[model samples]
Target chain A: MMKTVKIKKYSGELQDFDMNKLINSLRRSQADENLVQHVARNIVDQVEEGMTTKKIYQMAFNMLKSRSRISASKYNLKKSLMELGSTGFPFEKLVGKLMEFEGFNTQVGVIVQGDCVSHEIDVIAEKENNHYMIECKYHNSQGRFCNVKTPLYVQSRFVDVKQRWKSQVGHDTKLHRGGLYTNTRFTTDAIQYGTCVDLMLVSWDYPPQNSLKARIDKAGLYPLTALATLTKTEKRQLLDKGIVLCKEVYENPILLEQLGINESRQRKILDDSLKLCSAINTLI
Target chain B: MMKTVKIKKYSGELQDFDMNKLINSLRRSQADENLVQHVARNIVDQVEEGMTTKKIYQMAFNMLKSRSRISASKYNLKKSLMELGSTGFPFEKLVGKLMEFEGFNTQVGVIVQGDCVSHEIDVIAEKENNHYMIECKYHNSQGRFCNVKTPLYVQSRFVDVKQRWKSQVGHDTKLHRGGLYTNTRFTTDAIQYGTCVDLMLVSWDYPPQNSLKARIDKAGLYPLTALATLTKTEKRQLLDKGIVLCKEVYENPILLEQLGINESRQRKILDDSLKLCSAINTLI
Candidate 1:
């Protein structure tokens, strides 16, 4: 006998369940075809009439977690990045650290004098002979997407900064390289405009192999928000005290004291960080 | 000797001398012709190079404070009202109390259902055969004025509420009267539109006789911000605790203990409240 099914949305509104949404989310994690189908079917069969979307996510996440840790991390990546916005300063700092790991000397939250106006650059990175003026867009909500207007606005700002630097300090100062980085995905229009304007666009999944997710995974520079051992408040406290990278806690166990995590949880976090970092090292 | 003159603006920008501005401001306070001239001339003469507008105001205020207490209060009225915005809740409470003293049974911060939408009415009052909805516009800055757009927005909201009440409960519901009450002066356009629309406009000096200032003066219901005895934080604390009216504090001497004011200061505050209230009583 068929049963009537309803799922509670994030907004607490109950609606008819859609199987395709779960399937797409699972496929995005690069789960195996059979496992994805099996997980989706299992969730549908187990889901009650009034189960919340959060509980549904948990059921699927737990199933994915057992199969593949990396896939589970990728599935939970968006939420982890969203948690970084407890304070904007920490997110900028994390972005700077990520750029640093990519072999660029970076400065976070710097006020640079442009010819016409002063611009606050989120991240300024310098490689061998190139300079990048990065604008880091952070969103606290999962539903917020970086759209075309953002790139357009940032490109104009970048032009002003580039012109100012060229006029004031001579043409040798290369401030033309501009990038818009966001923890969320960019809209199709944003990608098109950014590519046309030669503005570097870095988001969660764009550029496939060199996207923000790939870079973080390759560098083993997971943000503190990625650690499931820490509570939301604990992660916020850690971020507040300027601890953004899980590697920081791994290198110096003393930082975990700030989180007030019990001895066992602290060990688990450190062990997880070390194992994750080593696993990335093996891939390289 | 001609002194190098400069006046620092509220935005902290220093500009060259302008004499007419000061003269016009003094005249608007309804000061006597000679007093206005004398005060303006004296301030300009005593003003040193690079002196702020605040210092100039203090010089004129000191002069007026000694000559006429009413004039001084009138001159300082805008600033006093601005302090009411330390928190919006207290200002709404104060407006409700003012309405209560005017023989209307008042409610503060009530959510009323409209036909198309729900509105959080700032002050709702009911009398013998009339019901009034008041929207309290509170501004924390001296330069901010209630403009035409405010009344236009409020008028639309009033229509929704009126329509909803009419449709739901017939014509005898008595939700016709709507008033826009603000602690600051209204723009000329706002006054014109509100007058044309028959929306009661109660501001600092509009309508001449029954203005907000006049009503507060007649009722002797000065807000806690009007008390010169309390510090900024102390006033905020009193406002937060729902002790909005000086009359409330005057009747309850125990409230002073929460402020941590010394015996002498507490006595002074109570005395000032009693004197101010009695002064209004004498006016009638």
Candidate 2:
């Protein structure tokens, strides 16, 4: 069936289902051409009026899962990121790691002196003549967009911190920028305010070219939680131990042994992580 | 037995027991002088190291509850204000009523045009030549202080709103200001930023001169949720109907009848409300 169907988004917004979007995501999972077509067709056939995008995603994920565990894990990246933590500290660490992978000296949580007061900045990244103070807004709950108030307060803090940074020696020539990164979406007003104030706004799908999802996919920085072989408990344990990247598991197979997994299971898990991260950039 | 005890506050901070503060609270409950002295003596005698201020308040409340429901209800004012709903609309309305009692023309939940965008102002009070844009931060959980981020964002919103307000005709000679009211305490940082930006901040125990608790008691504008006679459901029903003040019950006993409360009980409840609000200002 080639019929157009309305799909409800996490934000309760309704929009006509785009077949190309689903196909593109499935292809991004590294699924073969035949399997992608099969999954896309299955989703299109099962999709009905007022079905939530969540349900549609689940259907596609299940189809992909029955075929390839590696592809399924890749497809499950968003939900895996959501499992990071309620407080978003793990997510902050993930972001800091991403920046580190890109040759930036990054601090996950550091207390920075502002002009008026001190601020506990989530991530501070410094690279060649460029310094970024990033605030990571993580919501475990779906559809909780970072609103205008976030950027409003963040902008003020940025101004205060930037003022203090400017007063330091050797900072005069350095480019200091403020960034807001959230796992979920940013409201239009948040985007507007953040943009108006020249704050780098990055969310799941915002800013089109270099969104959080795009950056993660490009970097092959899938979180350890995204591994389908790992249980929730195992995922949480890995997260607790600061093993955020699937690439970390592949690099250190002994970490699985530390988790009390059998030698055979450790090999399987490590193999899966390696195959998933085979396309990862050579920086790490 | 009159030894000083290091009691823990709701914010997890340690503080020494002050008999005079407890005694003063009892006196404000409108309990007789003898009862206030007796309660103070009992609290002082029972005060133990590491006991929470919450526990101390509960002990005093139970002692007052047995002697006088009116006094207990009055003493329960802070907790009652907290029960004004989780979303805090009722608290906003109660604030609007308090402002109304003070003869200021007030609008709660007003949408005002800002310089760049629009803002949903919590409370806007105007009188004579003064206009105030107020934001109310209500927290159901105890010890959640309004942090510096509050004033930081509020100041930005206020600046945006004030700029738009100034553009209107006949506003040139009038004074525009910003106010922030919270049911909880404000962090020292919040107070500092607010003060620096000239934002009038009123919290439960802040300012010492004109705090939220003081204003509510002084105006005799106790929330209807403070009535010990009303059940949770009944209070919610009254709150839903926009009947926030205890004085509203005294002025109109029929509201109880609307809640399916019988005649005799309604009379008793009204009498209790009257006794609680008997010290109300003549202006109210």
Tell me the TM-score of chain B in each candidate.
0.79, 0.91
TM-score of chain A of 1: 0.81
Q: Give all TM-scores, in the order shown.
A: 0.49, 0.84
Give the range of the ten consecutive residues with the poorest summed lDDT in model 1 chain B.
B68-77
Model 1, residue A86: distance off in Å is 3.3
Top TM-score prediction, candidate number = 2
Chain A (alone) TM-scores for all candidate structures:
0.81, 0.91
Per-prediction DockQ, in order?
A: 0.02, 0.46
| Model 1: fraction of native contacts | 0.00
Please provide, for model 2 over A35-79, each residue's C-alpha lDDT reduced to its tens digit, 9 standing for 90 to 100.
Answer: 999999898888999999999999999999899988898888889
- The runs of at least 3 residues in candidate 2 whose Cα sits more than 4 Å from the true structure, single-residue gaps closed, are A1-21, A42-59, A62-69, A100-103, A127-129, A170-175, A260-284, B1-21, B41-59, B62-70, B100-103, B170-175, B228-234, B250-284
The 10-residue segment with the lowest total lDDT in model 1 chain A:
A167-176
